[model samples]
Target: RTVYVNGAYLPETEATISIFDRGFLMADAVYEVTSVLDGKLIDFEGHAVRLQRSLDELEMAAPCTQEELLEIHRKLVELNDIDEGLVYLQVTRGSDGDRDFVFPSADTKPSLVLFTQNKPGLADNPAAKKGAKIISIEDIRWGRRDIKTVQLLYPSMGKMMAKKAGCDDAWMVEDGYVTEGTSNNAYFVKDGVIVTRPLSNDILHGITRKAVLRMAAEAQLKIEERLFTIEEAQAADEAFTTSASAFVMPVVEIDGVALGDGTPGPIASRLREIYLDESR
Candidate 1:
C-alpha cells in the first residue's frame, strides 16, 4: 500500500521516521481516523476540526491548512482507490537531538504521516451479528485522552487482556464509572433511553458517538449523556459501541454477564440503521 509521509507519497515500506522523532521516542503525537465510504469522506470537517483542537492542546502547529489537508487526504484516497476503508493521519513534533523534557526548537518542522487501509465489514461478520462480548478493565490512560494522542499503551494492554478473556473489546472503568472502550465509545439503552458518558477530557469524544446521539434524537429516542457505571451497564436492556469502522454494534454481554436477552436488542439495531443512514 502507498503511504504519505510529510509531503510525499511512497510505498509503505519506504515511509520512515527519524529515530530522534519525539513521536517515535516518547509517543508525542496526535492522530485522526476517518472512514471512506464509496470514496466519500465521512464527517471530514468535524474530524479536521478535532484534529486541530488536539494539535492546539498539545501546543503543536498543524502541518497544513484544513483545506490543504483535506485535498491531500482525498488525493491519497484516490491514489490508493480505497473505497471502503479508513484514512489515518498523524502529526508529531519533529526529530531533535536526544532530549528528555525540553521542547524542540521552533524552527523544527512537525512530522506528518498519512495512510489508508481497508476495514473488515463489521456488518458481515457473524460476531457482530450475534453481538460481541466485552470485558471491563480499569481506565489507566493519562488524563489528556481528549487530545487524541498516539500514546496508547495502556489501552493496548487492556485490549489484549480483553482478547485473552474471549471478549471482542475492552470497556474502561474509572472511579467506578465507565469511560469508554479502548478505541471506541460505549453506550447502553435502558427502557428505550440511550445513555453514554458526557464529553470530557477523560474520553475521546468520538465522531460516531456524536452521530449516534444525533440519530437517537431524530428517532425520538431519549438520550442521556452522563456517567453510567459497569453495574448499570450490566443491567442495561441493551449495550453497544460506536467507532469510525464499527458504526454501531451491540454488546450482548460484558464481563461474562449477559445483557438483557443475550442477543442484539431492538434499540441497538434501530440506532445502527440511523447511524449508517446519517453517516452516509
Candidate 2:
C-alpha cells in the first residue's frame, strides 16, 4: 500500500511521524474517513467540511486546502487501487523538538497524512443482513465528544467488551441515555418513526448520520431527535447504526434481548437500500 506523509507519497513502510508529535504524545489530532465505492469517493465534500469543523474546533491549522486534500484522497485511492474501501486522513500538530504540557508556538507546522484501505465488499457487507447484537457500556469518554480526535482508547475497550460478551458492538450510555455506539451513531425505529439523540456535545455528529437522516426525510420517513434509553431500544421495533465504514447496519438484539423476531426490520433494510442506491 502507498501512504502520504508531509506532502510525500511513499510505501506504507516508509511513512513515519515524529515520536514527539503532539498527536502521538497528547492525542492532539483530528481525522476523517471517507469511503470509496466503484473507485469513487462517497461524500468527499461532507467529510471535508466535517474535517475542517473538527480542525477549527481544536484550534489546529489545516495542512492544506480542501482542494489539495481531495486531490490527495483521489491520488491515494488510485495508488492503492481501492475500489470499495476508505481513505483515512489525519492532521497533527507537528513536533517542537520536545514535549511540554503547553501548546507549541504558532509558527510550528502541522503534519498531514493520508492512506487508503481496500475493502472488496464494503457496501454489500453480510453483517447488515444478519443484523448486529449490541451490548451497552458506560460512556466514560472525555467531555468533547463532538470533536473527531484520535482518542479512541475507551471506544476500543468498549469494542473489546462487546467481543467478550459475544456481541457485534457496544452502545455507550450516559445519564441513562444512549450517547452512541463505540464507533457509530445509534438509532432506532418505532411505530414508523426514526428516533435518535439530538446533536450535542454528548455524541459525535456523524457525517453519515446527517446524510441518512436527510435521505430518510426525503423518503418521508418520520424522525424524532431526542434522548433514548437502553430499555427503550431493547423494546424498539428495530434499530440501526450509521458511520463511514458501515453505512447503515441493523441491530437485532440489545443487551441479550431480541427485537422483533431478531431479524433486520423492513424500515432499516429499505433505508439501507435507499442509502446505497442514492449514495452510489
Could you say which candidate leads in lDDT?
A: 2
lDDT of 1 by residue, 32-146 (tens): 9998877788999989999999989989978999998999899989998876888999999876667567888777899999999875563354666789799999998889888
lDDT of each: 0.88, 0.94
- Candidate 2, lDDT over the whole model: 0.94
Global fold similarity of model 2 (TM-score): 0.99
| Cα TM-score per model | 0.96, 0.99
Model 2 agreement with the true structure over 5-102: per-residue lDDT tens digits: 99999999999999999999999999999999999999999999988999899888889999999999999999888899999999998879899988
Clash counts for the predictions, in order: 0, 0
As for candidate 1, its clashing pairs are: none
- Cα RMSD, each candidate: 1.3, 0.6
Native RMSD of candidate 2 (Å) = 0.6
